[model samples]
Target: MSDSEETYKSIAVLGIGTVAAPLIEAGLLANNASVLVITRPSPKARQIPEGAHHAAIDYTDVSALTAAFRKHSVEVVVSTVNHEALDVQPAVAEAAKKAGVKLFVPSEYGLPSAGHTEGVLLVKSRFVDSLVAAGLPYARLYVGGFIEWIPYLFAINETGKFNIIGEGKAPATFTAISDIAGFLAYVLTHLPPSQLHNVSFRIQGERKTPRELAALYGDKAPLVEISEFPPSVKDGAFRKFLQVAFNAGFASTGYDAAEGKDDEKRAGSSNSLWPGHQWKTVKEVLNL
Candidate 1:
Protein backbone atom coordinates (compact mmCIF):
# COMPACT_ATOMS: atom_id res chain seq x y z
CA MET A 1 0.00 0.00 0.00
CA SER A 2 1.11 3.54 -0.63
CA ASP A 3 1.73 5.24 2.74
CA SER A 4 1.63 8.92 2.02
CA GLU A 5 1.40 11.52 4.77
CA GLU A 6 -1.19 13.32 2.70
CA THR A 7 -3.66 10.63 3.73
CA TYR A 8 -3.90 11.83 7.33
CA LYS A 9 -3.86 15.49 8.20
CA SER A 10 -5.15 16.64 11.58
CA ILE A 11 -5.20 13.72 14.02
CA ALA A 12 -6.46 13.81 17.59
CA VAL A 13 -4.79 11.55 20.17
CA LEU A 14 -7.05 11.05 23.16
CA GLY A 15 -5.31 10.81 26.54
CA ILE A 16 -1.67 11.49 25.79
CA GLY A 17 -0.66 9.20 28.64
CA THR A 18 1.58 6.19 28.77
CA VAL A 19 2.18 4.29 25.51
CA ALA A 20 -0.02 6.53 23.38
CA ALA A 21 2.18 9.53 23.98
CA PRO A 22 5.20 7.79 22.51
CA LEU A 23 3.17 6.18 19.78
CA ILE A 24 1.95 9.58 18.69
CA GLU A 25 5.47 10.92 18.93
CA ALA A 26 6.84 8.18 16.70
CA GLY A 27 4.10 8.69 14.15
CA LEU A 28 4.77 12.42 14.06
CA LEU A 29 8.49 11.74 13.54
CA ALA A 30 8.31 9.34 10.56
CA ASN A 31 5.16 10.74 9.01
CA ASN A 32 3.86 14.26 8.64
CA ALA A 33 0.67 13.50 10.58
CA SER A 34 -0.21 16.57 12.66
CA VAL A 35 -1.28 15.52 16.16
CA LEU A 36 -4.14 16.98 18.22
CA VAL A 37 -3.93 15.95 21.86
CA ILE A 38 -6.95 15.68 24.16
CA THR A 39 -5.94 16.18 27.77
CA ARG A 40 -7.76 17.02 30.96
CA PRO A 41 -7.35 20.58 32.13
CA SER A 42 -4.81 19.91 34.82
CA PRO A 43 -1.27 20.74 35.83
CA LYS A 44 -0.30 17.52 34.05
CA ALA A 45 -1.33 18.94 30.67
CA ARG A 46 2.26 19.99 30.09
CA GLN A 47 3.17 16.34 29.71
CA ILE A 48 1.50 16.18 26.31
CA PRO A 49 4.12 15.78 23.61
CA GLU A 50 5.32 18.75 21.67
CA GLY A 51 4.95 19.28 17.88
CA ALA A 52 1.17 18.89 18.03
CA HIS A 53 -1.96 20.81 18.90
CA HIS A 54 -3.15 20.34 22.46
CA ALA A 55 -6.61 20.81 23.98
CA ALA A 56 -7.77 20.41 27.55
CA ILE A 57 -10.65 17.95 27.62
CA ASP A 58 -13.03 16.57 30.25
CA TYR A 59 -14.13 13.13 29.07
CA THR A 60 -17.18 13.11 31.29
CA ASP A 61 -18.71 15.72 29.01
CA VAL A 62 -19.16 14.30 25.51
CA SER A 63 -20.31 17.65 24.14
CA ALA A 64 -17.09 19.28 25.24
CA LEU A 65 -15.03 16.63 23.50
CA THR A 66 -17.15 17.03 20.40
CA ALA A 67 -16.29 20.70 20.42
CA ALA A 68 -12.61 19.91 20.61
CA PHE A 69 -12.80 17.58 17.61
CA ARG A 70 -14.70 20.10 15.56
CA LYS A 71 -12.53 23.00 16.62
CA HIS A 72 -9.42 21.09 15.69
CA SER A 73 -10.95 19.83 12.47
CA VAL A 74 -9.72 16.43 13.49
CA GLU A 75 -9.80 13.90 10.70
CA VAL A 76 -8.76 10.95 12.84
CA VAL A 77 -9.27 10.22 16.52
CA VAL A 78 -6.97 7.84 18.44
CA SER A 79 -7.83 6.90 22.03
CA THR A 80 -4.88 5.97 24.24
CA VAL A 81 -6.20 6.72 27.72
CA ASN A 82 -6.34 3.56 29.82
CA HIS A 83 -7.92 2.30 33.09
CA GLU A 84 -11.00 4.46 32.69
CA ALA A 85 -11.87 3.20 29.23
CA LEU A 86 -15.43 2.40 30.28
CA ASP A 87 -16.25 6.08 30.79
CA VAL A 88 -13.72 7.76 28.51
CA GLN A 89 -13.99 5.49 25.49
CA PRO A 90 -17.73 5.69 24.96
CA ALA A 91 -17.59 9.44 25.46
CA VAL A 92 -14.88 9.76 22.83
CA ALA A 93 -16.92 7.75 20.37
CA GLU A 94 -20.02 9.82 20.94
CA ALA A 95 -18.14 13.08 20.60
CA ALA A 96 -16.36 11.88 17.49
CA LYS A 97 -19.66 10.93 15.90
CA LYS A 98 -21.21 14.27 16.75
CA ALA A 99 -18.22 16.18 15.48
CA GLY A 100 -18.06 14.13 12.28
CA VAL A 101 -14.62 12.77 12.95
CA LYS A 102 -13.87 10.47 10.01
CA LEU A 103 -11.75 7.86 11.73
CA PHE A 104 -11.62 6.51 15.30
CA VAL A 105 -9.17 4.16 17.01
CA PRO A 106 -10.37 2.72 20.27
CA SER A 107 -8.18 1.94 23.32
CA GLU A 108 -7.91 -1.74 22.43
CA TYR A 109 -4.18 -2.19 21.96
CA GLY A 110 -4.15 -5.91 22.66
CA LEU A 111 -6.17 -9.07 21.93
CA PRO A 112 -9.35 -8.93 19.88
CA SER A 113 -12.21 -7.95 22.17
CA ALA A 114 -14.57 -9.64 19.69
CA GLY A 115 -13.95 -13.12 21.11
CA HIS A 116 -14.76 -12.35 24.70
CA THR A 117 -18.15 -13.92 25.60
CA GLU A 118 -18.73 -13.23 29.27
CA GLY A 119 -18.06 -9.58 29.43
CA VAL A 120 -21.09 -7.80 30.79
CA LEU A 121 -19.08 -5.01 29.14
CA LEU A 122 -15.43 -4.37 29.81
CA VAL A 123 -14.54 -0.67 29.52
CA LYS A 124 -12.67 -1.14 26.28
CA SER A 125 -15.45 -3.28 24.91
CA ARG A 126 -18.02 -0.66 25.78
CA PHE A 127 -16.10 2.01 23.95
CA VAL A 128 -15.73 -0.41 21.04
CA ASP A 129 -19.46 -0.87 21.07
CA SER A 130 -19.94 2.88 20.83
CA LEU A 131 -17.65 2.92 17.82
CA VAL A 132 -19.82 0.29 16.11
CA ALA A 133 -23.08 1.87 17.13
CA ALA A 134 -21.95 5.36 16.11
CA GLY A 135 -21.03 4.00 12.66
CA LEU A 136 -17.77 5.90 12.91
CA PRO A 137 -14.86 4.68 10.83
CA TYR A 138 -12.83 2.62 13.28
CA ALA A 139 -9.93 0.13 13.41
CA ARG A 140 -7.98 -1.62 16.20
CA LEU A 141 -4.56 -3.23 16.44
CA TYR A 142 -4.41 -6.53 18.36
CA VAL A 143 -0.69 -6.75 19.09
CA GLY A 144 -0.89 -9.21 21.98
CA GLY A 145 0.82 -8.70 25.37
CA PHE A 146 2.79 -5.74 26.55
CA ILE A 147 6.29 -7.08 27.30
CA GLU A 148 6.82 -4.20 29.71
CA TRP A 149 4.32 -5.67 32.18
CA ILE A 150 5.53 -9.25 31.96
CA PRO A 151 8.83 -9.27 33.85
CA TYR A 152 7.47 -7.59 36.97
CA LEU A 153 4.22 -9.53 36.98
CA PHE A 154 5.92 -12.85 36.33
CA ALA A 155 9.09 -11.91 38.24
CA ILE A 156 11.24 -12.70 35.22
CA ASN A 157 14.96 -11.86 35.05
CA GLU A 158 14.90 -13.49 38.51
CA THR A 159 12.98 -16.59 39.44
CA GLY A 160 12.84 -17.49 43.12
CA LYS A 161 9.58 -15.63 43.58
CA PHE A 162 7.19 -15.54 40.63
CA ASN A 163 3.50 -16.06 39.96
CA ILE A 164 4.27 -18.36 37.06
CA ILE A 165 1.93 -21.26 36.50
CA GLY A 166 2.33 -24.29 34.23
CA GLU A 167 5.06 -24.74 31.64
CA GLY A 168 5.91 -21.19 30.55
CA LYS A 169 6.93 -22.69 27.25
CA ALA A 170 3.57 -22.35 25.66
CA PRO A 171 3.90 -19.86 22.80
CA ALA A 172 2.12 -16.57 23.59
CA THR A 173 1.48 -13.27 21.92
CA PHE A 174 3.19 -9.97 22.73
CA THR A 175 3.80 -6.56 21.19
CA ALA A 176 5.89 -3.70 22.38
CA ILE A 177 4.17 -0.33 22.76
CA SER A 178 6.42 1.11 20.09
CA ASP A 179 5.63 -1.62 17.57
CA ILE A 180 1.93 -1.45 18.30
CA ALA A 181 1.81 2.25 17.47
CA GLY A 182 3.82 1.74 14.30
CA PHE A 183 1.37 -0.91 13.09
CA LEU A 184 -1.59 1.10 14.36
CA ALA A 185 -0.43 4.16 12.45
CA TYR A 186 -0.42 1.98 9.37
CA VAL A 187 -4.00 0.80 9.95
CA LEU A 188 -5.64 4.12 10.91
CA THR A 189 -4.15 5.67 7.81
CA HIS A 190 -5.47 2.87 5.62
CA LEU A 191 -8.79 1.59 6.97
CA PRO A 192 -11.46 0.30 4.60
CA PRO A 193 -15.27 0.04 4.30
CA SER A 194 -15.73 -2.31 7.26
CA GLN A 195 -16.23 0.72 9.60
CA LEU A 196 -16.07 -2.07 12.23
CA HIS A 197 -14.47 -5.51 12.12
CA ASN A 198 -14.32 -8.65 14.24
CA VAL A 199 -10.86 -9.68 12.99
CA SER A 200 -7.76 -8.33 14.78
CA PHE A 201 -4.34 -7.91 13.18
CA ARG A 202 -2.00 -9.66 15.65
CA ILE A 203 1.77 -9.43 16.21
CA GLN A 204 4.46 -10.45 18.69
CA GLY A 205 8.24 -10.47 19.16
CA GLU A 206 8.66 -13.77 21.01
CA ARG A 207 6.62 -16.76 22.19
CA LYS A 208 8.85 -18.89 24.40
CA THR A 209 7.59 -21.03 27.23
CA PRO A 210 8.25 -20.20 30.85
CA ARG A 211 10.65 -23.10 30.88
CA GLU A 212 12.52 -21.71 27.91
CA LEU A 213 12.79 -18.23 29.36
CA ALA A 214 13.64 -19.75 32.74
CA ALA A 215 16.33 -21.88 31.21
CA LEU A 216 17.77 -18.90 29.40
CA TYR A 217 18.16 -16.79 32.57
CA GLY A 218 17.26 -19.10 35.43
CA ASP A 219 20.84 -19.93 36.35
CA LYS A 220 21.63 -16.23 36.43
CA ALA A 221 18.74 -15.44 38.78
CA PRO A 222 16.34 -16.97 41.26
CA LEU A 223 13.54 -18.92 39.56
CA VAL A 224 10.79 -20.69 41.40
CA GLU A 225 7.80 -22.42 39.87
CA ILE A 226 4.66 -21.09 41.55
CA SER A 227 2.35 -24.05 41.16
CA GLU A 228 2.67 -27.82 40.95
CA PHE A 229 -1.01 -28.77 41.00
CA PRO A 230 -2.47 -30.94 38.23
CA PRO A 231 -3.63 -29.06 35.15
CA SER A 232 -7.26 -30.08 35.68
CA VAL A 233 -7.30 -28.67 39.20
CA LYS A 234 -5.38 -25.49 38.48
CA ASP A 235 -7.18 -22.17 38.35
CA GLY A 236 -6.37 -21.59 34.68
CA ALA A 237 -4.71 -24.99 33.95
CA PHE A 238 -1.37 -25.78 32.28
CA ARG A 239 0.11 -27.05 29.01
CA LYS A 240 -1.94 -24.35 27.30
CA PHE A 241 -1.98 -22.05 30.26
CA LEU A 242 -0.89 -18.96 28.35
CA GLN A 243 -3.55 -19.48 25.74
CA VAL A 244 -6.18 -19.79 28.44
CA ALA A 245 -5.04 -16.53 30.10
CA PHE A 246 -5.39 -14.72 26.79
CA ASN A 247 -8.83 -16.20 26.25
CA ALA A 248 -9.92 -15.58 29.82
CA GLY A 249 -8.13 -12.19 30.06
CA PHE A 250 -6.06 -13.39 33.01
CA ALA A 251 -2.82 -13.16 31.04
CA SER A 252 -2.09 -11.75 27.64
CA THR A 253 -2.11 -14.24 24.73
CA GLY A 254 -4.20 -14.90 21.60
CA TYR A 255 -1.65 -13.90 18.92
CA ASP A 256 1.85 -14.99 17.90
CA ALA A 257 4.51 -14.26 15.30
CA ALA A 258 3.24 -16.76 12.79
CA GLU A 259 3.90 -16.74 9.08
CA GLY A 260 0.82 -15.50 7.34
CA LYS A 261 -0.60 -12.50 5.52
CA ASP A 262 1.34 -9.26 5.54
CA ASP A 263 0.84 -6.79 8.43
CA GLU A 264 -0.53 -4.01 6.21
CA LYS A 265 -4.05 -5.36 5.65
CA ARG A 266 -6.49 -5.71 8.54
CA ALA A 267 -9.65 -5.75 6.45
CA GLY A 268 -8.40 -4.00 3.32
CA SER A 269 -5.81 -1.30 2.83
CA SER A 270 -4.99 0.01 -0.61
CA ASN A 271 -2.00 1.90 0.75
CA SER A 272 -0.10 0.47 3.72
CA LEU A 273 1.79 2.77 6.07
CA TRP A 274 4.52 0.26 6.93
CA PRO A 275 4.81 -2.02 3.95
CA GLY A 276 8.58 -2.30 3.62
CA HIS A 277 9.42 -0.60 6.90
CA GLN A 278 11.15 -3.14 9.09
CA TRP A 279 9.71 -3.39 12.60
CA LYS A 280 11.80 -3.65 15.78
CA THR A 281 12.30 -7.13 17.23
CA VAL A 282 11.39 -8.29 20.73
CA LYS A 283 15.10 -8.78 21.34
CA GLU A 284 15.80 -5.19 20.39
CA VAL A 285 12.88 -3.91 22.48
CA LEU A 286 14.09 -5.98 25.44
CA ASN A 287 17.52 -4.48 25.15
CA LEU A 288 16.07 -0.98 24.90
Candidate 2:
Protein backbone atom coordinates (compact mmCIF):
# COMPACT_ATOMS: atom_id res chain seq x y z
CA MET A 1 0.00 0.00 0.00
CA SER A 2 1.14 3.55 -0.70
CA ASP A 3 2.07 5.82 2.25
CA SER A 4 -1.20 7.68 1.76
CA GLU A 5 -3.19 4.44 1.97
CA GLU A 6 -1.30 2.87 4.89
CA THR A 7 -2.72 4.82 7.83
CA TYR A 8 -6.05 4.19 9.56
CA LYS A 9 -8.08 7.39 9.91
CA SER A 10 -10.96 6.43 12.17
CA ILE A 11 -10.42 4.67 15.55
CA ALA A 12 -12.69 3.66 18.43
CA VAL A 13 -10.99 3.39 21.84
CA LEU A 14 -12.80 1.24 24.42
CA GLY A 15 -12.79 2.39 28.05
CA ILE A 16 -11.36 5.76 29.15
CA GLY A 17 -9.34 4.66 32.13
CA THR A 18 -5.71 5.41 33.04
CA VAL A 19 -4.24 4.33 29.69
CA ALA A 20 -7.14 5.26 27.42
CA ALA A 21 -7.39 8.90 28.53
CA PRO A 22 -4.03 9.93 27.09
CA LEU A 23 -4.56 7.73 24.03
CA ILE A 24 -7.67 9.76 23.22
CA GLU A 25 -5.65 12.94 23.68
CA ALA A 26 -2.85 11.69 21.43
CA GLY A 27 -5.29 10.57 18.72
CA LEU A 28 -6.95 13.98 18.74
CA LEU A 29 -3.53 15.66 18.51
CA ALA A 30 -2.66 13.48 15.48
CA ASN A 31 -4.94 15.83 13.44
CA ASN A 32 -5.52 13.27 10.69
CA ALA A 33 -7.32 10.67 12.83
CA SER A 34 -10.80 10.81 14.34
CA VAL A 35 -10.98 9.50 17.92
CA LEU A 36 -14.10 7.85 19.29
CA VAL A 37 -14.16 6.82 22.96
CA ILE A 38 -16.58 3.96 23.77
CA THR A 39 -17.86 3.19 27.26
CA ARG A 40 -20.47 0.95 28.89
CA PRO A 41 -23.82 2.49 29.72
CA SER A 42 -23.82 4.08 33.17
CA PRO A 43 -25.89 6.49 35.23
CA LYS A 44 -22.78 8.20 36.56
CA ALA A 45 -21.62 10.89 34.19
CA ARG A 46 -18.33 10.44 32.36
CA GLN A 47 -16.22 13.43 31.38
CA ILE A 48 -15.91 12.80 27.69
CA PRO A 49 -12.63 14.17 26.35
CA GLU A 50 -13.17 17.27 24.27
CA GLY A 51 -13.04 16.89 20.45
CA ALA A 52 -13.53 13.09 20.60
CA HIS A 53 -16.76 11.25 19.85
CA HIS A 54 -18.31 9.17 22.68
CA ALA A 55 -20.52 6.08 22.67
CA ALA A 56 -22.04 4.02 25.48
CA ILE A 57 -23.21 0.55 24.52
CA ASP A 58 -23.73 -2.90 25.99
CA TYR A 59 -20.58 -4.84 25.24
CA THR A 60 -22.52 -8.10 25.12
CA ASP A 61 -24.85 -6.71 22.48
CA VAL A 62 -22.90 -7.32 19.30
CA SER A 63 -25.49 -5.57 17.16
CA ALA A 64 -25.24 -2.37 19.20
CA LEU A 65 -21.44 -2.45 19.12
CA THR A 66 -21.41 -3.16 15.39
CA ALA A 67 -23.74 -0.24 14.77
CA ALA A 68 -21.50 2.11 16.73
CA PHE A 69 -18.46 1.01 14.73
CA ARG A 70 -20.29 1.52 11.47
CA LYS A 71 -21.63 4.90 12.59
CA HIS A 72 -18.14 6.14 13.34
CA SER A 73 -16.61 4.44 10.30
CA VAL A 74 -14.19 2.95 12.83
CA GLU A 75 -11.28 1.31 11.03
CA VAL A 76 -9.61 0.09 14.25
CA VAL A 77 -10.94 -1.04 17.66
CA VAL A 78 -8.60 -0.46 20.61
CA SER A 79 -9.75 -2.22 23.79
CA THR A 80 -8.49 -0.61 27.01
CA VAL A 81 -11.06 -2.41 29.12
CA ASN A 82 -9.60 -3.20 32.55
CA HIS A 83 -8.67 -6.77 33.45
CA GLU A 84 -11.81 -7.50 35.48
CA ALA A 85 -14.00 -6.78 32.42
CA LEU A 86 -11.75 -8.49 29.85
CA ASP A 87 -14.25 -11.31 29.28
CA VAL A 88 -16.31 -8.88 27.20
CA GLN A 89 -13.54 -8.75 24.57
CA PRO A 90 -14.58 -11.85 22.58
CA ALA A 91 -17.93 -10.18 22.01
CA VAL A 92 -16.16 -6.93 21.08
CA ALA A 93 -13.87 -8.81 18.70
CA GLU A 94 -16.87 -10.42 17.03
CA ALA A 95 -18.43 -7.00 16.58
CA ALA A 96 -15.22 -5.58 15.13
CA LYS A 97 -14.99 -8.48 12.67
CA LYS A 98 -18.61 -7.98 11.65
CA ALA A 99 -18.05 -4.26 11.14
CA GLY A 100 -14.99 -5.04 8.97
CA VAL A 101 -12.66 -3.18 11.31
CA LYS A 102 -9.06 -3.43 10.18
CA LEU A 103 -7.33 -3.91 13.56
CA PHE A 104 -7.94 -4.66 17.27
CA VAL A 105 -5.56 -3.58 20.05
CA PRO A 106 -6.00 -5.77 23.13
CA SER A 107 -5.50 -4.35 26.66
CA GLU A 108 -2.12 -5.80 27.56
CA TYR A 109 -0.23 -2.79 28.89
CA GLY A 110 1.68 -4.76 31.52
CA LEU A 111 4.34 -7.47 31.61
CA PRO A 112 4.81 -10.15 28.90
CA SER A 113 1.70 -12.37 28.99
CA ALA A 114 2.08 -14.91 26.19
CA GLY A 115 3.01 -17.85 28.43
CA HIS A 116 1.06 -17.15 31.60
CA THR A 117 -0.97 -20.12 32.88
CA GLU A 118 -3.05 -18.69 35.71
CA GLY A 119 -4.65 -15.46 36.98
CA VAL A 120 -5.29 -12.26 34.96
CA LEU A 121 -2.44 -13.01 32.59
CA LEU A 122 -4.12 -16.29 31.58
CA VAL A 123 -7.37 -14.45 30.94
CA LYS A 124 -5.44 -11.93 28.78
CA SER A 125 -3.68 -14.70 26.84
CA ARG A 126 -7.03 -16.39 26.18
CA PHE A 127 -8.51 -13.14 24.88
CA VAL A 128 -5.75 -12.98 22.28
CA ASP A 129 -6.60 -16.56 21.35
CA SER A 130 -10.21 -15.53 20.86
CA LEU A 131 -9.08 -12.74 18.54
CA VAL A 132 -7.20 -15.32 16.52
CA ALA A 133 -10.27 -17.57 16.48
CA ALA A 134 -12.35 -14.68 15.14
CA GLY A 135 -9.64 -13.99 12.53
CA LEU A 136 -9.17 -10.42 13.77
CA PRO A 137 -5.73 -8.89 13.38
CA TYR A 138 -4.21 -7.41 16.54
CA ALA A 139 -1.26 -5.45 17.94
CA ARG A 140 -0.12 -6.35 21.48
CA LEU A 141 1.92 -3.82 23.45
CA TYR A 142 4.07 -5.10 26.35
CA VAL A 143 5.34 -2.18 28.41
CA GLY A 144 6.30 -3.74 31.74
CA GLY A 145 5.04 -1.74 34.73
CA PHE A 146 3.78 1.83 34.66
CA ILE A 147 6.24 4.33 36.11
CA GLU A 148 3.63 6.05 38.24
CA TRP A 149 2.85 2.82 40.07
CA ILE A 150 6.44 2.19 41.08
CA PRO A 151 5.98 3.81 44.47
CA TYR A 152 3.03 1.58 45.29
CA LEU A 153 4.82 -1.49 43.94
CA PHE A 154 7.85 -0.73 46.04
CA ALA A 155 5.63 -0.24 49.12
CA ILE A 156 6.84 3.31 49.63
CA ASN A 157 4.28 4.90 51.87
CA GLU A 158 3.73 8.42 53.28
CA THR A 159 6.34 7.55 55.88
CA GLY A 160 10.00 7.13 54.95
CA LYS A 161 10.21 3.35 54.55
CA PHE A 162 11.13 1.66 51.27
CA ASN A 163 10.36 -2.07 51.32
CA ILE A 164 12.70 -4.03 49.09
CA ILE A 165 11.91 -7.59 48.09
CA GLY A 166 14.91 -9.92 48.23
CA GLU A 167 18.24 -8.48 47.01
CA GLY A 168 16.54 -5.82 44.83
CA LYS A 169 19.14 -6.37 42.15
CA ALA A 170 16.96 -7.85 39.45
CA PRO A 171 16.45 -5.66 36.38
CA ALA A 172 12.91 -4.56 35.57
CA THR A 173 11.46 -2.36 32.83
CA PHE A 174 9.27 0.69 33.40
CA THR A 175 7.49 3.11 31.07
CA ALA A 176 5.65 6.34 31.70
CA ILE A 177 1.87 6.18 31.19
CA SER A 178 1.96 9.12 28.78
CA ASP A 179 4.65 7.43 26.71
CA ILE A 180 2.55 4.28 26.31
CA ALA A 181 -0.47 6.28 25.25
CA GLY A 182 1.52 8.44 22.82
CA PHE A 183 3.25 5.42 21.27
CA LEU A 184 -0.06 3.63 20.69
CA ALA A 185 -1.67 6.61 19.01
CA TYR A 186 1.43 7.37 16.93
CA VAL A 187 1.72 3.81 15.61
CA LEU A 188 -1.96 3.27 14.91
CA THR A 189 -2.12 6.43 12.79
CA HIS A 190 1.30 6.07 11.16
CA LEU A 191 2.21 2.38 10.65
CA PRO A 192 0.79 0.36 7.81
CA PRO A 193 -1.51 -2.59 8.44
CA SER A 194 1.31 -4.95 7.52
CA GLN A 195 3.35 -3.76 10.54
CA LEU A 196 0.48 -3.27 13.02
CA HIS A 197 -1.27 -6.61 12.62
CA ASN A 198 -0.34 -9.51 14.90
CA VAL A 199 2.70 -7.67 16.22
CA SER A 200 4.00 -7.47 19.80
CA PHE A 201 5.73 -4.15 20.31
CA ARG A 202 7.93 -4.34 23.44
CA ILE A 203 8.91 -0.90 24.71
CA GLN A 204 10.59 0.45 27.85
CA GLY A 205 11.28 3.99 29.00
CA GLU A 206 13.90 2.88 31.53
CA ARG A 207 15.44 -0.32 32.90
CA LYS A 208 16.33 -0.20 36.60
CA THR A 209 16.73 -2.52 39.55
CA PRO A 210 14.67 -2.14 42.69
CA ARG A 211 17.73 -0.91 44.59
CA GLU A 212 18.46 1.68 41.95
CA LEU A 213 14.85 2.87 42.10
CA ALA A 214 14.94 3.07 45.88
CA ALA A 215 18.09 5.20 45.82
CA LEU A 216 16.27 7.76 43.70
CA TYR A 217 14.19 8.60 46.78
CA GLY A 218 17.43 9.66 48.56
CA ASP A 219 18.45 8.96 52.17
CA LYS A 220 15.10 10.09 53.53
CA ALA A 221 13.64 6.68 52.69
CA PRO A 222 15.29 3.75 54.45
CA LEU A 223 15.47 0.46 52.55
CA VAL A 224 14.24 -2.72 54.27
CA GLU A 225 14.68 -6.05 52.50
CA ILE A 226 12.43 -8.94 53.38
CA SER A 227 11.53 -12.33 51.92
CA GLU A 228 7.77 -11.78 52.50
CA PHE A 229 5.48 -8.83 52.77
CA PRO A 230 4.57 -7.45 56.19
CA PRO A 231 0.93 -7.38 57.34
CA SER A 232 0.86 -3.65 56.70
CA VAL A 233 0.98 -4.20 52.98
CA LYS A 234 -2.34 -4.89 51.24
CA ASP A 235 -2.74 -7.75 48.76
CA GLY A 236 0.23 -9.49 50.32
CA ALA A 237 0.05 -12.66 48.23
CA PHE A 238 -0.17 -10.91 44.89
CA ARG A 239 2.50 -8.43 45.89
CA LYS A 240 4.75 -11.28 46.93
CA PHE A 241 4.17 -12.96 43.57
CA LEU A 242 5.18 -9.76 41.77
CA GLN A 243 8.40 -9.52 43.78
CA VAL A 244 9.21 -13.14 43.01
CA ALA A 245 8.49 -12.56 39.32
CA PHE A 246 10.84 -9.61 39.31
CA ASN A 247 13.59 -11.55 41.06
CA ALA A 248 13.16 -14.35 38.54
CA GLY A 249 13.53 -11.88 35.67
CA PHE A 250 9.88 -12.03 34.50
CA ALA A 251 9.14 -8.34 34.99
CA SER A 252 10.73 -7.05 31.81
CA THR A 253 8.81 -6.31 28.59
CA GLY A 254 10.25 -9.16 26.55
CA TYR A 255 11.77 -12.57 27.28
CA ASP A 256 13.87 -12.88 30.44
CA ALA A 257 16.67 -15.14 31.66
CA ALA A 258 14.38 -17.33 33.79
CA GLU A 259 12.54 -18.60 30.71
CA GLY A 260 14.56 -21.45 29.23
CA LYS A 261 15.60 -21.75 25.59
CA ASP A 262 12.46 -23.71 24.74
CA ASP A 263 10.23 -20.80 25.67
CA GLU A 264 9.11 -18.38 22.95
CA LYS A 265 11.48 -15.51 22.29
CA ARG A 266 9.76 -12.12 22.25
CA ALA A 267 10.64 -9.35 19.80
CA GLY A 268 13.22 -6.82 20.96
CA SER A 269 12.33 -3.29 22.18
CA SER A 270 10.52 -1.35 19.43
CA ASN A 271 11.01 2.16 20.83
CA SER A 272 12.77 3.15 17.60
CA LEU A 273 9.47 2.71 15.74
CA TRP A 274 8.54 6.22 16.93
CA PRO A 275 11.62 8.16 15.97
CA GLY A 276 12.81 11.24 17.92
CA HIS A 277 10.43 10.89 20.89
CA GLN A 278 12.31 11.12 24.19
CA TRP A 279 10.94 8.50 26.58
CA LYS A 280 10.44 9.66 30.18
CA THR A 281 12.62 7.98 32.80
CA VAL A 282 11.99 7.16 36.49
CA LYS A 283 14.15 10.01 37.77
CA GLU A 284 12.30 12.45 35.55
CA VAL A 285 8.96 11.03 36.68
CA LEU A 286 9.96 11.33 40.37
CA ASN A 287 11.36 14.84 39.82
CA LEU A 288 14.76 13.63 41.10
Best by TM-score: 2
Worst 10 residues of 2 by lDDT: 259-268
What lDDT does the true structure give each of the candidates?
Answer: 0.59, 0.82
TM-score per candidate? 0.75, 0.91
User: Global lDDT for candidate 2?
Assistant: 0.82
Residue 28 error, candidate 2, Å: 4.3
Instruction: Residues 185-253, candidate 1: write the lDDT tens digits.
Output: 655554443422433455554554545544554445455655543343333333234444533333333
Highest-lDDT candidate = 2
Candidate 2 lDDT score at position 82: 82
Name the lDDT value of residue 74 in candidate 2: 94
Cα TM-score of candidate 2: 0.91
